[model samples]
Target: MESETIQEPLDRFLVSVERKAFVMARMATRDTDEALDIVQDAMQALVEKYAGRPEAEWPPVFYRILNNRIRDWHRRQKIRNLWRGWLKPWSESNDRNDDPLEQIQDPGVVDPGEGMDRKASMARLEVALANLPLRQREAFLLRAWNGLDVASTAVAMGCSVGSVKTHYSRAIHTLRQFLEEYRP
Candidate 1:
């Protein structure tokens, strides 16, 4: 049998969970490149901020950074969309207008409807997850997918445990509603 020993436990821990984190990021962002970027940002944050902390605490801290980055990413997207919407009415003229804001596409954003390659169940689950409210998705994905405890989920989400529980409950309820007809 070949031994697969990672040098440090921290390295091993990060290696073990990185793929899941990427998946979580992908599910949140709905863009592979953006998801990869988010995961990279999260890794940088984890290394910078939490490297000195205990290894066991890394999960919560890493996810907290990741969740925060995801929030920031969404915020940036909203702002960009808002600007684009506001500018669209003015920029329809024949006058040449070159603005850097217009030139700057949101980083790592892929074209929409580019995920047609996913298998049926994965695609359905992606839609259901996407339909979830941000907080509900955060709660469910953190608690259910990441295997974080309620307290850890709260910490990652920057909310109270009660809020986490509420979001998770509502997420479960909503998901059941969404997927009820698809039961096999």
Candidate 2:
């Protein structure tokens, strides 16, 4: 009874973030259904494992759970691909036209007073971000998109400050390179 009282706020917090968490997971997985499953898994894992932790700690803890699930999914996909590759070595050839940039089309609908040039810039930035390495992508999103500070990012990623710094620096450099090449 006391535990449920303590966990009610955490439950509310998770509910508030559920939609955005699904969006983030979808972007990470590029699969809507898989993303939904990941979000559900993350929420369940949080409730079961960390429900008693202080409220101040839930954000990073929630993200850590979500991140681990995503990584596990990616790993399983990798193994599946490896087996599929052995069965069909021509699978890579079938995907020759699936350029990442082509998939990043902006809908071209903008709010009043928003400039086309700025929209173009944002679309280009999204492409660059999509091309980032997985760890770098996660670090950038957790820090910039989610607005978590370095310490929180470190907690979420299960890494030291230095590794986060390295990943972030590399992400910035790679994004700059992509922007220069595409000039969008």
Candidate 3:
């Protein structure tokens, strides 16, 4: 008697994790459309690389690949910036004519029910977050937002547990300082 090996379980696991994976990519890129593309690419790579592996290995394997892809994307962006700097025209004006206030307004603040209405307050927090180095943001999001354990976050980040702890601690401290200053 021949028993068929079931692939259904692996397919189900992929489906379950896909949405969260997309959300993670979106946070890293801060763009929904780009995140969707990254997720699709990650899914295809996972199917090609790990679909034949044991179901137990799929989660970490898929995330490792996705993280590597995101890192590669960042590296390419940096290289492109360097090239743009070399090739950019000198004719462009350094002076800005646009109103800084227009760019500074937070739509989220307009609804006081949603949150505080202090424009400078929200801007301070956002600027603080943007200023954080990438690893810190990644660590904070993985641990605090995504609710991953330290060990799992370490695996996803391809870093030591201690490194993850350091990044998370710095991110939390920075965020706390920024938020405390803005507290109503």
Point out where model 3 deviates above 4 Å.
Answer: 1-7, 54-56, 89-105, 108-131
List ranges where model 2 is wrong by over 4 Å. 109-114
Model 2: lDDT to the true structure: 0.83
Top-scoring candidate (lDDT): 2
Q: What is the C-alpha lDDT profile of model 2 across 1-184, one tens digit per residue? A: 9676977797788987788788778877889999999999999998888888888888888888888888899999999989999999877667677687787787476743448656766788876776677789878888877888888889988999888888988898888887787763
**Residue 113, model 1: Cα distance from true site in angstroms:** 28
In what order do the candidates fall by TM-score, top score first? 2, 1, 3
- Candidates in order have lDDT scores of 0.77, 0.83, 0.73
Tens digits of lDDT, candidate 1, 30-149: 789999999999887787667777777888888888889889999999998789878796765447655322332233424334443234334455678876788899899989988899
Q: What's the CA error at residue 70 for candidate 3, in Å? A: 1.1
Q: Could you tell me how far off, in angstroms, the CA of residue 72 lies in candidate 3 after the best superposition?
A: 0.6
TM-scores for candidates 1 onward, in order: 0.76, 0.88, 0.72
The candidate scoring highest on TM-score is 2
Minimal lDDT window, size 10, model 3? 1-10
